[model samples]
Target: MTTHPTGTREDWLKARLDLLKAEKELTRRSDEMAQRRQALPWVKVDKAYRFETEDGPATLADLFRGRSQLLVYHYMFGPDYTAGCATCSTIADGFNGFAVHLAHHGVMLSAVSRAPLAKIQAYKKRMGWTFPWASSSGGDFNFDFNVSFTEAQQRDGGIEYNYQREPAWTAQGIGDTMTKRGEGPVAENADMTGTDVATYTRERPGMSAFVREDGVVYHTYSAFARGLDGLWGMYQWLDRAPLGRNESGTWWRRHDEYERQA
Candidate 1:
């Protein structure tokens, strides 16, 4: 028979201890970032932003629906677009649980996109998500938050009426504004600026938050594709074999080999 190491038990225990330490470090970092996010500058919502609530036809202020704090996730779902972002849908799938917990914290959270009410509702059903997903059919909110693109700008690549360009982490609510929300001459949108608080939405990250004295709610974030790896825990599907694969720790699977079939 082959002989084993004299102190393999100690080695395994040491490895486990190291894993615990790393997990604690990650928790500490998250706490630190949360505090920093709270301290970040916040822009003011000057004009009354509009949204289609579950009750139908509501103003931006109405998004809170009575709560003081609000969190608006600018999911990508424009009228011209075919499907809502798959990655964002995954995040929403997980968000269903958080939606209830957030209310207990006195913080309200909802998702908005530029798609029509009917389309958005249909997509929500297809994904089986019960979270507060709403439509932003009439407003510059999507473009302002960098989720939706302009006609001319979308056609930059020569594809007419397409929203293709996906830029890396653009600044929050910084872009060209259409005439009265796509009616007049284009100019740099400076309406959602002013507070020391600046917010942004782009790739390579997963979600953002804003806090305030009266309560913080802002239109400035989107979680996409790999942008949501760090913020996980909902999917029991991830309990299979190792998620991080190869030399890159970024790859992961949602299910085990045997359970993948059913």
Candidate 2:
């Protein structure tokens, strides 16, 4: 009655054992990549970046919170948006649980966005998330980190993200130059955030790492696009599922949205 391949227990075990060998090799390669990532040189951060926190104004170094290291998730909540990006929100849901463990290990984790502090706080409360989220409103932190862009940049082909120059959205078939078809992941995500494609695409999702030593902060690492796959906890579980991701299109929502849909 099933469409999938039928196998006896012995057949299943043999196939699973072969998969286990590949899985172990992948794990070994992952470990080697982490070592190489750690060996990358740290770049000194000379700019004085500031942020608005629940406790008040804070600097990039203050985000470490007496720890030597800081991890910032570049959440895509542009100032004009009424809400956070649905995908970023899903990734952040895992943060509330592990942030405490990281703090105990001498590393502080926080999320930074260009939205105002008040907006961030309202959304945080709505999501019931207690993890540290900060506001970089009116600051160049997001732009400097290459996660936020301006309209001119979008139109003039000046935007660069994921470590490469991006073709201007104007030149693309979507955004302002094209009619809204209300289709595809980008358009759907733009609708979810209550913004046009141009505005939604202006902000990207990524993570950055910093370390403070001898009273100076240095940028250690950053990852964008698919590079962030490891941090999306749900995907790790889905990868082990029988159907393995089973994705067709934008199939996820903010965790709370599912409750409303139900």
Candidate 3:
């Protein structure tokens, strides 16, 4: 009565064993890639970037919090948005648990966004998240990192993200183009954030790594798009599920929004 392949226990074990070999090889490759990432050269940060934290104004170095390393999640919360990106929010949910562990291990983790400090605080409280969140409002940090873009940049195709040039977002089709018949992930995400596709897309989600050496901050690494797959905790578990990701369009929501959907 099932559509899936039927197999005896012996058959299942044989297939699973074959998969185990591939999985192990993937794990080994992942370890090698991590080493390569650590080997990448770091670029010195000379600009004096500032942020607004709950504790008041702070510099990029202060984000390390006495630690030598800092990991910033470039959260997609533009100033105009009423809420955070659902996908980014989901990724951040995992941060609250591991941030303390990172802090103990000489690494401080925080999330930076273009939204104002007050808006960030209200949303942080609503989500019950205690992890450090900072506001880079009126700051060029996001733009310098290629995670935030202006309307002119969007129209001129001046946006370069994920290490490549992105196509210009035309003003005429801004809203219509992003929403594919008012469906799919982008449109759904835009609706969730209470913004049109143009505004929602002005901000991007990514993570950046930095290290403070001898009182100077250096950029170590950055990842975007699919490069961030490893940090999405739920996806790791889903990969081991019977149906794997089993995705179609936008099938996820902010953890709290699920209750309302039901």
Candidate 4:
């Protein structure tokens, strides 16, 4: 580090060196991320959560099927809730295409929700996703991980994280929103419909890598529902161009402002 000599030979040399150093730092960071990506965390699962797979009753371990690495997208499909979540849909659009090379890397991806198999299947067909999907209806898995919630809890109040429930208290902070009600256990102002910034607020769904040795399937790690956002980075390439395919590229208006492609 040197003082501002102002336009001397030293300044030019220092500037060039700074650029090179920045480039190297960026490269180093990228390399570090690559290592972390390869270093998938292993988790131990003891709870036997229930789910509806393409077949029948499925345990949490059943999700992994035969793959060593599993990824589950937390889809929004509460049974009584008819429409899929808009934000979830946007994320799904980003996930339209797969590289087909994930399996070679030993990662299998799927989507899961609390909806019935029929509902999940219908949405998958509408979205044109070939990715695997499952339903969690029997247990509190959705509520447990904070993906879905009961109307009383969601309306009366609760924040669904990962897949568990946290009562909405209101010290006016993280776990204290309900305290703002100035009444009792639940807050009056506490919103039933969740906040706007909760785009990524859903818990990271579970992704587990199971290893079976001596006839026992041990739990490795089950990932979050929302952590799959990066798989569709290819969508970023579209923003470079202009509005093609009738405003598909335009952020000027919302999805509803125009009609669906008929």
Per-residue lDDT tens digits for candidate 1, residues 1-262, read 5474445888889987999898899889989976876666667666666778668888766766576677777675556545554435545666788888897887777888777888888777766778786787878766555555554443233221112343222222222231233222111111111111112111111243433446545533344434455545534345433553222321222222125534
lDDT of 4 by residue, 1-262 (tens): 6563558798889997998898899889979976775576544555677888777878766666665656666766556545455445556664446524654566666677776888888767766677667887667766655555444444344665544556543234334442332332122111221322122223233333454434344544344444543443434454334442233222222134246532
Candidate 4 regions with alpha-carbon error over 4 angstroms: 1-27, 30-41, 94-96, 150-229, 232-235, 238-262
Q: How close is candidate 4 to the true structure, as a TM-score?
A: 0.57
Q: Which stretches of candidate 2 lie over 4 Å from their true place?
A: 171-182
The whole-model lDDT of each prediction reads: 0.53, 0.90, 0.92, 0.54
Residue by residue across 1-262, what tens digits does model 3's lDDT show?
9899988999999999999999999999999999999999999999999999999999999999999999999999999999999999999999999999999999999999999999999999999999999999999999999899999988888888899887677644333545565457887898899998888889999999999999989999999989999999999999889899999988898989898999
Score residue 13 of candidate 1 by CA lDDT: 96
**Candidate 3 pairs with clashing backbones:** none
Candidate 1: 10-residue stretch with minimal lDDT? 191-200
Candidate number with greatest lDDT: 3
How many residue pairs clash (N, CA or C atoms closer than 3 angstroms) in each of the candidate models, in the order given? 9, 0, 0, 28
lDDT of 4: 0.54
TM-score quality measure for candidate 3: 0.96
